[model samples]
Target: MRGWIIYKQNEMLLRQEAYEIHRLLEVAKEENIELQVFSPDQFDLTVTRDDEKSILIDGKRQELPDFVMPRMGAGTTYFTLAVIRHLERLGVYCVNSSHSIETVKDKLFAQQILAEKNLPTPDTMLVKFPVNVALVEKQIGFPVVVKTLSGSQGSGVFLSKSPGEFDDLMQLIEATSPKANIILQQFVKASHGRDLRVFTIGGRAIACMERNSNGENFKANVSLGGVGKLYPITPEIE
Candidate 1:
């Protein structure tokens, strides 16, 4: 058995996630499945006149793998998504389906879909110029969580504790990036400084990690100075 993990092999492999990916590779090897790392920018997809689709890895055509693991980051999201789409055309299965990824990649779009499905989520509003402060206060209230549409890993996220703060934030954002896509989400006041990160696979909860700010900051993400505590999965968490 063979598989591929699509990622930015050059840069990301040097970060903390490198250990995670290496562990995956080691586990795969133990299971007699060869899992290779493949960079998103290192491949080219070609469609032939004979209606055959081929992928070139490091300038050489390669056979399609049994499965794919997508680790596409913010920088090459669209290009990697396109590559994943092409891979699906060649009958390769991805851990996360391409269409679902696309939907969630766009923050507002995903929220809209969730809202339509009646899933519980924070009330959110997409930012608009000449902003409606009244509507924002009515829907989101004070202490707003402002986030860029495509941000990840605690980047491009901000908080406005008051209406004045929100107004100042908009001014700064407009001055820096006039057309930046943003959204205002209601603050979950009770969840402040602590949150749970649950890992799910194949529609089943596998592990749960609690992140605590330790009174250092409002964000409870371990990557941002928070402490992590792993817990056994339970029915409530599931």
Candidate 2:
């Protein structure tokens, strides 16, 4: 058995010590599966005149893996997605389908889908220029959470404690990126300094953790100085 993990080569190299990739490789070894890692740029895709699809890795034809796992998250670019799509065409199964990844990359679209499914989601509104402060006050209220449409690891996220702060932040954003895509969400005070993180595979919850802010920031992201610990997976969390 063989598999591939698609991640940036540079990042993998930098974090090679005590990284998730090493753990995955170890598990694969125990299972008698030869798991390999490849950067998106390593593969060259081609479609032949006879409708045959072929991919070359490092400029040489190579055997396809039984499955692929794209782990780039927000770092995933159009080219990366294109590579994944090409892999799919060649009948490679990918964890977290490309379509789902694309949809969730857009914050508003993901929230809308969750709400439509009757999931309990914070009230969210897409922001537009010549901003509607009145509507925001009435609908979302103060102390809102502002976020860029596509971000990960708590980047491009901000908390506006009042109308003035929100206005100032929006003006700054407009001055720098006039056509920036942003969203406003009603802040959930109950989860202010901490939140539950759940990991799922095949639609089943496998692990749970709690992330707490470092007593300074509102975002409980470990990359931003947050602390994490194992947490019980209760029925409600599931």
Q: Which candidate comes out best when scored by TM-score? A: 2
Candidate 2 weakest ten by summed lDDT: 10-19
Residue 185 alpha-carbon offset, candidate 1, angstroms? 0.6
Per residue, candidate 1 scores C-alpha lDDT tens digits across 179-210 of 99999999988889888888888878899998
Model-by-model lDDT, in order?
0.82, 0.86
lDDT of 1: 0.82
User: How many angstroms is residue 86 displaced in model 1 relative to the true structure, after the best TM-score fit?
Assistant: 0.7
Q: Relative to the unseen true structure, what is the Cα RMSD of model 2?
A: 2.0
Pairs that collide in candidate 2 are none
TM-score of each model, in listed order = 0.90, 0.92
